[model samples]
Target: MAKSTTQNIRQIITKRFNGFFVIMLGAFGLLLFFLFKVVFVDGPTLKADASSKYLKERSIEAVRGNIYASDGSLLATSLPKYRLGMDFSVFKTSKMRDVFQKNMRPLAEHLSAFYKDRTADEYYYKLKSGFEQRKPYVLINMRLLDFQERKTVLTFPVFKLHPKNPIKTGVVFDKVNVRYAPFGQTAYRTVGYMKDKVRVGLEGAFDKELAGVPGHGIFEKMDKNMWRPLDGNKEILPQRGLDLHTTLDVDIQDIVELALMKSLDAYKGNYATAIVMETATGEIKAISNLMKNEKSPTGYSEFVNYAIEVSENDPGSVFKLPAMMAMLEESHMPLTATVTTGGKYTVYNKTMTDSHDYGTLTAQGVIEHSSNIGTIKLMQRVFGSKPSKWYDYLRNFHMLDPLDFQIKPVTGKPNFNVPAKWDALTYMWTSVGYSSNTSPLHLLSFYNAIANNGYWVQPIIVKNATKGNEVVIDYTQTQKRDSKPICSKETLDKIRIMLKGVVESGTGNNLKGTPYGIAGKTGTAQRRVNGNYIKGTYYVSFIGYFPVNNPKYTMLVAMDKPLGSSEGTYARQVTAPVFKDISDHIYARDMKIQRKLSGYLPDSLNNASLHHLIHPLDHSILYANLGFPRIEEDGRWLSFQLNKKEVKNYGLSFAPKKVANVVGMNLRDALFVLENQGLKVRAQGLGFVQSQSIPAGFPIQKNALITIQLH
Candidate 1:
């Protein structure tokens, strides 16, 4: 009877259990179906806010690329930082009130010391409020905590340290990379800046390659408002930005910046610009713009990029290089051919004037003096009957078009225009660098063509680019070397020789003795503002290169509205010295130029004597109010105060007496002049003047000894 009763009870219990299990399984299936519908189909159909909560995905931050200089020095880079926060409830502190305020005080103090945005009191208030509100996780520092500070915080009692949480914080710093410019504002404008955290300029143009693809990771929001890795997190490896190789040399860039600053400051000018390039390959070595911001007390810091930015009339005589090139290409005239130029001449019944009264001069002489009248005559000879031909010539040289560089131009029309109602003299004016608009880059490129033996290669900023070691730009073996004959080699030779003559005997005479022979032209044009030209405003410029026989570097400088008188003379007077300084500095460094002369210098030094040497052979002696005097056996004392030109010219003079070592006097001034004269100067002192080897009147031969002491 007992067995039977037990069996019946077991059977009844088993059936009930089975029925409950089936019902539970059915309920679970229905719940799963509802979840699927909500996630896939119904989710999208819901209200915007509801849909966002269910369907919107969190973003993975993209990794930024490293920026490098031409030689691969990391200029801009990203560094790692930390993010930290805490879950107020999980900090299991047993000492309740006794330790709560003490621990919290230190934490608040840490926050105060690290972050300047808030005070310790403010941090304490926020922490208290977060606890009162039952906030799950609270953010402390937005960036990485100091290593020492983080360590100290971790040792504190009951501070459940989740390197991801309090002290270190779970805010997910994730070792993110950000952009940094080491040479701050060096080439700031040209390199461009970030917009909304995206790179710009060379960085922006190639952002696609420089900006690496971001990685994704799956994470779940914790109950405490913190994030933790999901059980099976899906992730993608981040791709790094491509490394870019450029043609820019930091040394050359330094010279350009220095010269630009000097020009802007000296003239108290509105703005200034300078560019250096390799003549043969059309590689842009350096480009600088020193503009004046509106608030700038003096007009030397405008955000405008005068190199490519277009405005009417600011680019003064720098336009003449291209204008002259157009005329030369159109009119097959001899360089020595004569043209009559007065101070002003009428063209198409419109009066035009040369910067000076050049009278009758050869075509080459016109360039030497930068004669406006002569240029107009040349234009008339070429395009007077057919104005469109001048345009065609300019088009061939790319003067009327954007350079098509990596950087897009910022400005108006890309062509030089002689309006439909243009007169015969309009072409002449255009030829003389008037009635047109151009960038400093346009003129520099045109001169570069002349230096390149008429070959026009496209100028580029980035030499090569890499994407995960794959060459994107391929500058090394796959260099984009473009070559085309825009003018005859004979034409190039003539122009080059004429330019050398300008430096040798004409307006650019200041360029003589510049170690390497320079072939270039000077330009001075009046500023035309609001339809009328400013009488006194002048843009003085010089564009040329060194070792004219085998042209290497080509440079252009433009200074706007140089103060004082002398219309077109500013370049030859003010800018040419700077040009020489830049040229000599570069040729000495990269080209190994001095190596070729090494053997010769040693030979020259052996012949120089010290005893009979008074006034070091290469030491330029200057007397007050006296321009420059020849240093004979008897040396004249130099004036303490000296201008750049007078002092520079004095250093170029060789001693009339025997060569000796100059061991005393202004070492800084002496070094400046000696370097300019191509003489080596070594110093060992702190102040000015101490002792001497060369007496005041000794003749110091070229490349002679000059040692100075500062007392």
Candidate 2:
């Protein structure tokens, strides 16, 4: 019975074991079927799910536009920047291995030269490791590169991309917009700034045109909350902002800032401002406002747009210009009319005085000498009965009218007392730039009108706004025309003469002896502080235009009570020099003003050669302007010859360090060339350079002195 039970138990155990094996095989078969399904059917869908997810749409910022000066110099710009990277994906194919290997040394060498951050050997090792390991992505340079720089690097050896070639350099660059101001702190305030959504200057004025519109795009959310741009690119590309071409001449602006800073530094002035306007168009070429501050790194900073500030001090003698104009317009009074001006005159128990007493003076003399008493005397003579006649002329001249400047800086209209609130002494005081005030810019515009043949138009800072070649805002079109000038030509002629006399013989006598003519006024006004005029502290200013005969530009320079300056010489000491300096620069730059006086000589070859001086001047235009008969003269140095006896010298260009052929050059022109080549000059005699100690075409030597004998 035990044997029979054992046999049955064994048979049952074997059958159960076979059954368990069959069950295991079925489970394995089921697993294999699901694995086959996943590998073929579900693969694409699962991978797509892993690669993407719907997230909130993102706003892509448009490229901000560039702000350029009048000369096409970049002031503010937002450019796309890039970072260099490499991919060794090409290494996956053995067919391109030789081509890639051959480029390794040259590519490494080029990288070393371009970056200058690593040696050729170091770069070679890095390149080899990246290539051998077949790095999918390797950052070659983390440094941000400008558009031009990345473009240049693309042409280098292995990095170069070919239009026809199937293979790529395995190089890549990431891009982002970077805003830059090439000229730092030069026109810092005027070029503008934006902080906390509060903008200032041009930035604030044209934010819509400069900041650009933003674009919306749907992007895939990746690991670490990063965004991945979707293919089929559901992105709405942003439109680039319009480019602004401002009226500012950065070259002139730099000079103005330097000139003003120099004067302010020397005088220890608290604050100073200067503005240059195109005489005809009222376009501001340059404007600078600097305030004294110890906290600043440069001991000065620009914050307040004081050039256009409304609440400023009295303009002193400068205001006498409009006062005189009013007198001329109202009664048809001649500027030559005699007005007796004593040492002192008491009007309504208030005393008005002059620096020095003149027994009797013409109406023109009042403005020329900047005579406070004479001006008041003219006002008393002309408008004594109804001083409101003087008041009425203010409206006619647009004195109280606040300007709609392109810079958008004015807070209020001019600070002038109304006629209804006038006292007895108001007319007497107002006759000589007292009790009324305006911005330096307003004052500049007023002076600019006189320079612009009495045409009063608003000043604008932006020339135009452009998108590519198309104009978005033609500011020139916005300028309106007037049927009449500020005054009659006869009055303007007299005003011009009076202004010339000021520099030639009157209060502005110190500003005499300039090569070019200057027609303007010198004003020294008492600074009204806490409702009282400060004795030592005064606002000294100079407002004028250069080449008085034909004005091209007008400028105003004002200083708020320079520390070491006294009342009498404040304007002369501080502002006149700046005016003269800028005037000289402007005059020298004008091709129309290039005239040279030659010494008389016999019509011989020796002297005739003297007329053929080499200097960079277009003589064809010069001679044409002079109405000289065009003579047939051959050579690169274009010379204008009246005859063999009277010939004018000029030239084109000179290479550096090469001894210039200045045989026919004047002593001034000869010295100019030699000294510029780092050569010391010893010039002799009068007139043009006849002969030189050293021959032309020789290499220059350091501290070398070149002597020239002039005939």
Best by TM-score: 1
lDDT of 2 by residue, 1-711 (tens): 999999999999999999999999999999999998998889888777765454557888898889998877678887688877666866666756777789889988998988889999998888888888887566777678876677778788766646334237787675768766665566778888777777888888889998788898877553234454555767888888989999888657766876776677778787888899888888888888898666542346788888877746887989889888888877778767887888999877888778688878888888887789888878887888898878777777777877777677657488778878998888769879899877788788878888989888788889899999999889889875455898888778888889999899887787788777888899988899878987778898999998788888899988887887365447877898889887787666566654564885454753443345433333454555645444444535554444444654443456656888788765445654675465666655544678888889888774587778766
* Candidate 2 TM-score to native: 0.66
**What digit string (tens of lDDT, one per residue) describes model 1 on residues 156-268?**
43354444454323222234455655544556667766768654467777777677676666655533344544445566656766777677765577667656665555666
Residue-pair clashes per candidate: 35, 0
Candidate 1's error at 297, in angstroms?
15
Say which candidate scores most in lDDT: 2
**Candidate 1 local lDDT, residue 124:** 85
Least well predicted 10-residue stretch by lDDT in candidate 1: 610-619
Candidate 2, which segments miss by more than 4 Å at Cα?
1-54, 81-176, 219-233, 292-300, 410-412, 565-569, 596-711
